[model samples]
Target: MNMTDSEKAAKVIEALKAAEGEPAQIALPILNGLVGLVQGGGEAPLEFEEARSGAFLAICEIGKALHRGQPADQLWAPAIAAAERWQALAR
Candidate 1:
C-alpha cells in the first residue's frame, strides 16, 4: 500500500496518543493485551512467544518500509530507529 509521509506521520502520532497511558510503559504488555488470545504455558503448549515475536517483526518491518519508501509487503527493515527512540524515552 502506498502511504504518504503525512499520512504515516499522522498514523504514528495517533498511535502515540492512543498509547499515551500505561500502554507506553512496556511494549510487551501492549502486545500481550492486543493479541493475548494465544496464551499458553508449558503443559498446554502455546506459541505465544512466537506470535509476539512475529508481531514485533511485522511492526518493525512496516516502520522500515515506511521510512525507506519500499513496497510495504515486500520487505521491512528492523525498527531500530523506533526501538532506540522508545528505549531512550522508556528508560
Candidate 2:
C-alpha cells in the first residue's frame, strides 16, 4: 500500500530524529506540523503538497551546504539561476 503524505512526513521525522542534529532540531517541528496539514482536507490555507516539497527541498539543500561547510545561502545562487532558465524556456 502507498503511504499517505502524512505517513511519509512522519517517516522523515523519524529519520531526522534518529540523525539528531541541527537539521533534526529545525525540521522536526515543521514536519510535525506538516502531518496535520496533510490531514487537514481543503480547509488548510496553503496547498500542503507545495509547502511540503519546498520545505523538504530547503532542508536537503541546507543539509548539503552545512555538510560541505558552506553557508546555507549557497543554494540560492544555483536555484535562482535554474529557475530563471526554466522560466525563459517555452512551456
Candidate 3:
C-alpha cells in the first residue's frame, strides 16, 4: 500500500521509539520500516538516497544504544554523519 511522507515518517519514528531499550535485533524491524518508506515513494533517486541514509542512521543508532547503554539522541553520531554527507551530495 502507498503512504504519504508524513505517514511513513510517523510509522518509522514509532518503530524506532518502540525498539528503544530493546536488543540490537530490534533495529532490524526499524530497518524494514525505512525500506518500506523508500519503496513506497515515487521515482526520485534523491528520496531513495535520503531514506537509505536515514535507515543507516537509524540502524546505527539502535545498535549503539543496545550495545552501549546510551540514549537514542546520543547514539545518532553515525546517522548524523551519514545525513551530512547525503545532504551535501543532494545539494
Candidate 4:
C-alpha cells in the first residue's frame, strides 16, 4: 500500500524520536499530533517551510543527543548514511 506524505513524514519523525533523547521530549508530542492531523485528512498547521525547519532542528537535537552519549548510534548511523546518499544524489 502506498503511504501518504503524512505517513512518510511521521515515519521520519519516529526515527528522529528514536534517536533523540531528553531534548526532544517537548517537541515530539506536538509533531506527532500534527502527523495525526495529516493522517486524518486535516491540514497540518505548519507550512512546508516551517515543517522543513522543524525537521532540521529536530535532526540537530538528535545529533546533540548522540554527542551526549545517548545510545542511538545503531538507529541514527544508518539514517545519517541514507541522508548522505541522498545528498550525494542531489549533487
What's model 2's overall lDDT? Answer: 0.44
Q: Residues 19-39, candidate 2: write the lDDT tens digits.
A: 334453464454344333233
Query: Tell me, what's the RMSD of every candidate?
Result: 15.6, 11.7, 6.0, 11.8
Total backbone collisions, model 4: 0
- Name the regions of candidate 2 deviating beyond 4 angstroms: 22-46, 70-91
Off by over 4 Å in 1: 1-46, 73-91
CA lDDT, candidate 1, residue 59: 54
Off by over 4 Å in 4: 1-4, 20-46, 68-91
Poorest lDDT segment (10 consecutive residues) of candidate 2: 82-91
Candidate 1 vs 3: which has more lDDT: 3
For each candidate, how many residue pairs have backbone atoms clashing (under 3 Å)?
0, 0, 0, 0
Cα lDDT for residue 5, model 2? 52
Residue 2 in candidate 3, Cα distance off native in Å: 1.3
lDDT of 4 at 54: 46
TM-scores for candidates 1 onward, in order = 0.32, 0.42, 0.47, 0.35
lDDT of 4 at 58: 44
lDDT tens digits by residue: candidate 3, 6-78: 4555555555566555565665555555555534334557655675556565565656565665566555445
Quick one: ranking by lDDT, best first? 3, 4, 2, 1
